[model samples]
Target: MKNSKRWGRRVLSALAAAAVLAAVPVGAAGNGKSKGKPPASSHRYIEVQLLGINDFHGQLNVTRKVGGREVGRADYLAAYLKQREAENKNTLLVHAGDAVGASPPVSALLQDEPTIEVLNKLGFDVGTLGNHEFDEGVAEMLRLIHGGYHPATGDFAGADFPYVSANVVDAQTGKPILPPYVIKRVNGMPIGLIGVTLTETPTIVTPSGVAGVKFIDEATAINKAVRELKKKGVQTIVVLAHNPGVSNPDGTNASGEIVDIAKNVDDEVDVIFAGHNHAYLNAVVDGKLLVQSYSYGTAFSDVDLKIDPRTKDVVAKKAEIVTTYHDGITPDPEIRALVEKYEAKVAPLVNQVVGTAAETITDEQNESGESALGNLIADAQRAAMKTDFAFMNPGGIRADIEQGEVTWGELYNVQPFNNQLVKMTLTGAQIRQLLNQQWQPTQTRMLQISGLRYTWSASRPVGEKVIDIQLPDGTPLKPDAEYTVTVNSFLADGGDGFTVLTHGTNREVGPVDLDALVTYIRQLSQPFSAQIEGRITKLQ
Candidate 1:
């Protein structure tokens, strides 16, 4: 009562702060001006900034203790967008797919609903479908699309953005699973976004979930959709392709799938944002701008397109790949709070101690050629299947273990996805052919081996590359004898261009991948060390 005037001023300050916090920086009209008017150039040139991210895999925070730090998470991403809009009034945010599912415990607890809500809060304009989106099944995906709330949480917050998939069609009705394309007017420019997932979706996804669905040829579906959009007077077109990209071992863009797609793509499509292989790319293929950001939201791609006013055609295009570092940027408080809340709720399961590691296990060296981690995993699979040989893809190993101790969380980090281990028998000749294909220049053919030792000449051509092969007991393998081999379902079905593996005879062994690895680790109560000694030797 004695200091009523001071109390009034404090209340006023608090109200002012609240007002400032209420407005998210997304799509704010600059200079307090109306948004409907054309720029001073009278539409002479429309500067549209296309912001894209792909293969997020539900990582809601920065990865720590890797070679380098990676900054991501929905709120930090939102801050980045707001910063961009301040520079360019005409901006559109898009995703190239793999936005939901295959996430950590926090997201997995709610079936990735929290991630979707955060994406909506960040104002994603459009998104294509990724293979992981089908992890739960197509029906659930459709439910997620048409105003369905999370099964765990009874909230009514639906997808504020649109999901597009032109190639995925119902086998019986021959109709798209989702709308083939979405046309949006951004900054007064009518733009068309077409979505196309990989045709290999049939093999990668569960057969039952996609039982009545057929994924058409990507190039064919994209061309047809672009033509339809063009007929509707949409001159600028962007294709969100979930197919893999071509990249060199150095992480630089190479001329392969992207080039092939560009050559066959419709002329009307001005830009192509690609994903699925988790490659980083920014280049011009056949006069069209092509860009792919690295996976896990470690990077963001900003593409600027200058459109001609009269013709509505793109006159110029430029792309910039920006690495998201958590250091310089402050995490948006709201998003940080949400992440903390979810983390606390899921802490018991996510942070539960599992086991300990006697030595370091890493994926860094595993992808290059042969690796200790890969060898250990392959050995584990071989032991579980009791097979003649075993192979595990380097990309399948997600994380590393420290030397001092290991935990269940660490193992999950290594094999996060719940892929199944499948055993099959193949003729010796067929196995030889499969080994030969591993030497393909464009393929990441590094194989983790069990009960084998071999040397190869990198300079030699395909079939002649495998210089030697041996059984665990130091016996030469007979070309006529059949061998039982074990591999994850992904490779057994021709993932990573291993088409030869498809010729194997299905043995029908049922062992879940991550569970098998966990069991293998538990059996070895003592700390175990993996040596990369002679698993693979490159010829000089």
Candidate 2:
């Protein structure tokens, strides 16, 4: 993109130096040069508004409760965003990432085309990729972004907004798959936006999702983009980083991957928008403004920058994390209509009653890392495959089973990845090894199991955490004995770092996870309830 007009050449005066001292975070002001001089009067200070959202997992018709207030839904989010955009003539809408994957039936059922369509209607200016965007792998991601034919969705026009990522690159060519940055002019002042996702994407996403791509260091890529942008005479810069960050409501004690990136990047970079943790953050760290709104359509980040026209540098910046409370505004009619269209199309399958829940079965784990919903899902997969045992990854369980009248859509929401269940043979020793893999150095990912029980001690080392494994018949697991095991395609392929699964033999793929869940629920007694059953034990 080209700048609308060239900025007048000027050196920073004492006033500009003062603004830099006041506006820029401590130690963040560059080496006393290239700082922009502020306009003489307050009226000359150009107010540019940047509205950003992140981790919107395509809840087109879903509403969520935030702080006891009902907030969210595509149409309501659109109304709030549009209202905020109208408050300033110089405004841009952007997203950090995860706009599509792990979505509800309304969008995921249609290949997430409706999510992109709604973002198009809202006129998003730029975006970056989150780990979820890579859930289906690179080719499909590009198909969603650049418009291509899919057997499910047919011909499609992709996102109108540009997707920029400074770090993600093709493995073979070692070149960025998308542009590193995009420059957009607001009121004739150029603002450069650089995008990058977390380098840990590979660990969280299914292995196939990140195949043939590599995510380099976020800060290194960002600094490179800053140098390139500066060569293009762009003084103002913002980063859309799909990395996690969090701070208190008062903007104190900032921490996370994004904070590190902001500190390491060039001082000329002004604002950083963060995502992936799905938390609230609006803090000034290392002389840069960092902000992230909570995930879904629940909230958004409103960042305003005061730019000096002559110098085209950000002179002042502030941000507000706004919740999309439905109380104050009417939903946008156009987006509402679009959402209804998709919802109606999916209603036939989504609304079908599969079973009833006596009470909510939540993904909330106990001290031993076992959850009711996780147990339910693992049992379902095991039943579908007729396996001796089954393991379910906690991340695969997305939502709670609300009390009464469970629907196909609800089960779909709970297991949206549609991974086919795989029955494989693993020796008892291998099962113990797989259970121990949960305590990796970076994080713990406890697997939910069915037809077996195990105890783990936090005091044990990473690879030796499992104290004992036993079958339901009270027989101690024997190392030499091979047993049938079931897991989703993601786990079978070693997703979430369960590499031991890759060693399994005699693998047979069965029904998709959602279908297995639906079938299991349908056959259950009415008003079924699942609970923690002492499958995992913690050492005191």
Candidate 3:
């Protein structure tokens, strides 16, 4: 019953043609509502299906298309999970992180109430927190953690599951913001779940959103959690880490921060369910299964684990990633209804045509961290404030700008966060320092730039990276000359490990980033097309 690779999802005994394949006897309990322990057998191996979703980002609608087929709709996702569960006796559903934040208006405007409500209905047991989870700040996250109706999105009973984060520390109390870990009983086996996020969280997230919080090392946090869980007599452990590795489509060799963290974590940890970078991968690192599903509700990871009852340990494991296609699967009626109800509330605003795109500008980054969408966003920020130049973090661009009519939904997907533009002044030397600040030991902060041009050598050390700097008008930058600049408040406050941006003087604030994009699109008399235009040249 184990599906070995990251692909290979075929229902073994799917009776219904419309139902997603599951030849294996469908479990009545994958939603964490049914008892999955084997019948009193002393030496039986209990088969369990662990369904994982990561980086959902509140995609309730069926908007993203693959080969002209609608995939990743909330209803379709629900239907797939339901059908898959019917085949396995024991099952558990969990999310890695980023369930909300940078989401569409249908979910974001309601303050992500709809997102939380739908997840509750799906019956998740536990989930971790990603950087986006703190977009609205700790107070709003608390509102999501404990059940109650939110003022903006109205009624939401809150999540049925606990949000765990062992690494996120509260600055005031110097303790983990949420529960470090949670233990769930699947059948009779005590399954311990440890959650953690990248310690670089502060650099990527808005400083204000995470004002009083600090993130600790992922490996250290998980090891400590493992020691605590072992003391509770739990033998089976799963690490739901919000930090992810670079996407390797083949599921072969891959390396990133998560890879390093995985190599260093205690061997007591079993599978690592990762997120935050929206990568789809499944590979064994240090003999531990590491898996991730592509983001935006477009895909999910289906992992099957066999636990030995006598030894109380995982004996066998199989993992595969499944795309949530719409045609062959039946969309859950209840979830579809829920989506319609929430979407109706924001229809007027979300349906509006904000702009048009003659080409598809995606958020995917290059080796040097350049993206066409990032460049477009930077251009808009500079245009909005009429500054000498502007910058955008690569992580800020969420989705691609598809061809044809650009609706508010598409723009919202791109700039989901309501970050305001901050205009300021900095000298040429300070700007060079900003460029040099891009290279961290574990990260490269390639700020998408506009109204200026620069070249960098990867072979060069951190402080000596930037060379041949010039303004957009082809004027060479003078070391002592100061120029007006515009950036998001996040970067202005030294977000994303770039401190040079914070040194700028004459700070000024502008409209929200989304608003600027909407206004920029409306003003365009023709379809807008984005290009790299040699704005950034990286020499490896």
Q: Pick the lDDT winner.
A: 2
TM-score of each: 0.81, 0.91, 0.87
lDDT of 1 by residue, 5-110 (tens): 0011112222222222322221121112212333365446878889898877677753532123434675666666666656776888889887866566666666
RMSD of each: 11.5, 9.4, 6.6
Write candidate 3's Cα lDDT for 1-540 as tens digits: 000011111110121111122212222222222223335545568877899998887888845654445667799889878776776857788898888887788888888888988898888789998777888788888788786666665665678889888999988887998999999888888898888976766766666678888888889999988999998888889989887664444457666667888899888788999887666567788878888776777767788888988877898887766667666567899999999999899999888987778988776566665778888888889999999889887667666789989999779877777888999999989988888987887656578888988888988877998888987788898889989999987788887777888778999899999899888878877688887778788876
For TM-score, candidate 2 versus 3, the one ahead is 2
Clashes of 1: 4
Candidate 1 Cα outliers beyond 4 Å, as residue runs: 1-44, 62-70, 86-89, 147-158, 203-210, 244-254, 308-310, 364-368, 424-430, 440-442, 459-461, 480-484, 492-508
Task: Kindly indicate the candidate among 1 and 2 with the higher lDDT.
Answer: 2
Off by over 4 Å in 3: 1-43, 65-70, 246-251, 362-372, 538-540
**What's model 1's overall lDDT?**
0.70
The candidate maximizing TM-score is: 2
Per-model lDDT: 0.70, 0.84, 0.77
Total clashes in model 3, counting residue pairs 3 or more apart in sequence or in different chains: 16
